[model samples]
Target: MNKFTLLNGLVVPLDRANVDTDAIIPKQFLKSIKRSGFGPNAFDEWRYLDHGEPGMDNSKRPLNPDFVLNQPRYQGAQILLARENFGCGSSREHAPWALEDYGFRVIIAPSFADIFFNNCFKNGLLPIRLAAEQVDALFKAVEAMPGYRLKVDLERQTITAPDGTVYPFEVEAFRKHCLLNGLDDIGLTLQHVGEIAAYEAKHRAAQPWLFA
Candidate 1:
């Protein structure tokens, strides 16, 4: 996991609400837990015209030009500006994996499903909740300007708009700390490696007969 400090990147507006995990990274692509190679298939149904399957050549597939992601201006976007109830439906960590793999570091929305929100933190993606009106304002800004971008300061817990407007957001202190230090669940556990090794050694000595 990479530490997320500051991210200044183009924002792609996913206007619809109630975006479920399946929509983010459809059910078919969930078979792999490698947490990678899913970027090309992210939003498969909406991103392309044909039915998407595993191992399909994404490059040759026909893209849906109307989709926000396929729009030329939004290419290489790193921040996702979404509406309420984003990541609703089934709790699949693959949603965040697809987004992160596609290079999205931050997701801004009025609200998010609880499970999906928690998964985002564990997978190194920052899911931000803001006031509904604030999100609406951002959507308008993104539509008004081409190549619009925002600066997200996770430590400061603020988002800076292109016009110098700053919006303050809240994040749990523990989640904030984990992202700042790039510590996932595994990373957190590994911090106690020495103690774990000692405990295992003592257990082996006490239960030598079990091993034999």
Candidate 2:
């Protein structure tokens, strides 16, 4: 996981609602849990014209020119601007993995599915929920300007537009801390390595037969 203290990146508007986990990364690509190489398959069905399969040469696949992601203007976009009820349906963590791998660090939406929202934090992707009106404004702004970018300050809990207008958002303190330090669940547990080691040693001493 990477630390997400602050990010200033181009915005890409998804312009859809109720985007499910499967749509984010289709079920065919779920066999591998490598957490990477899924970027090519991100939004597979919508991004390409042909059916996508694992190990297929995505470069040769026909792209959907109408899709927002395939547009030249939004290339290399790192912030995803989306509508309400984003990330709905199945609770696959691969959704965020595909998003992160696709170069999006933050996802701004009016609402998100419960499981997807939680998975974003754990996977180092910042999913910010804002008022429906605010999201609509962002979508408009992004579309109005080419190469539109926003500055996200996690420490300040604010997203600043190019005009210096600030929209404050809320995030849980502990999740904020973990993201700031790039700590995942395993990283969090490893923080108490010494205590764990000591406890194991003490247990072994108390029950030598169990160790033997």
Candidate 3:
């Protein structure tokens, strides 16, 4: 897990609503839990013209020129601007993995599915919920300018536009703490390593037969 203090990156507009987990990373690619290599296959159906398989050469596949991601202007974008109900449908963690692998650290949307939103925090991706009007304005601003970028400050809980327009967003304090410290579930548990070891040793001494 990576600590997400602040990020300033180019924005890519998805321009669609009701984007589900399967759409983010199709079902076929879910076999591997490696949390990587899925970047190439993110949004497989919409990103490419042909059907996508697990081991297919994505480089040779025909790309959808009309799709926002394939556009040259938005290349190397790290912030995804999306609409309402983003990350709906099945609660697969792969969605955020694909997004993170594709170089997006933060996702700004009007709304997000509950499960997906939670998964983003665990996986080091920042899922931001803002007012519908604010998201619309951002979409417009991103489209109006090429190579548009935004600065996201997690500690300050603010997103600043190029013109210095600041948009305030809310995030739970506990989640903020975890992200700031780069602590995932396992990382959190490991924080009490000494206590866990001591407890185990005490238990072994109390019940030597169990250890034997």
Candidate 4:
């Protein structure tokens, strides 16, 4: 996982609520757990006009002109501005994988599903919850200006708008620490490698026959 410290990047609004995990990355493409290559297939159903499948040539597929992501101005956006209940439905971890793979480091929404919210932190994606009115303001700003961007300071736990307006958000202390250090569950465990090795060595010596 990548450490998230600060980000100043373009913001694109998805303007939709109740966006389920399936829509974020369609089920057909969930065959791999590589946590990559899903960027091309993010929002597959709405991004393309035709049905998508794994191993399909997405480059050749028809793109939906009406889709927000397909618009030229929103290209290379790293911050996603969304409405309430942004991520809902089945708790597939793939959803955050696809979002992170798609270059979105931070997702700002009024609310998010419990599981999806937790998944985002594990995948190094910052899912920020703000007041509905604040999200509305962000969505409006993003659409009103091309190349709209914001500054997200995780350490400060605040989002700075283009006009210098600041919004303070809250995150669990443990989750904040993990993201700041880029430590996932596996990484957290590995931090105590010496202790783990010591315990194993002692166990083997105490019961040598068990190992045999």
Reference-based lDDT, residue 21, model 3: 93
Candidates in order have lDDT scores of: 0.93, 0.94, 0.95, 0.92
Model 4 spans > 4 angstroms off: 189-212
For 74-107, candidate 3 gives per-residue lDDT tens digits of 9999999999999999888899989999999999
Which stretch of 10 consecutive residues in model 2 shows the poorest summed lDDT? 181-190
- Let me know the TM-score candidate 2 reaches against the reference structure: 0.88
Of 2 and 4, which scores higher on lDDT? 2
User: lDDT per residue, candidate 4, 1-212, as tens digits?
Assistant: 88999999899899888988889988988788576788999999999999999988999999999999999999999999988887898888889988998999999999999999999998889999999999988888888998899999999999999889999999999999999999878867999999999999999999999999
lDDT of 1 by residue, 76-128 (tens): 99999999999999988899989999889999999999999999998789999
In terms of lDDT, the poorest run of 10 residues in model 1 is 27-36
Model 4: lDDT of residue 71: 98
Runs of candidate 2 with Cα error greater than 4 angstroms are 190-212
lDDT of 2 at 5: 95
Model 3 clash tally? 0
Clashing residue pairs for model 1: none
Highest lDDT model number: 3
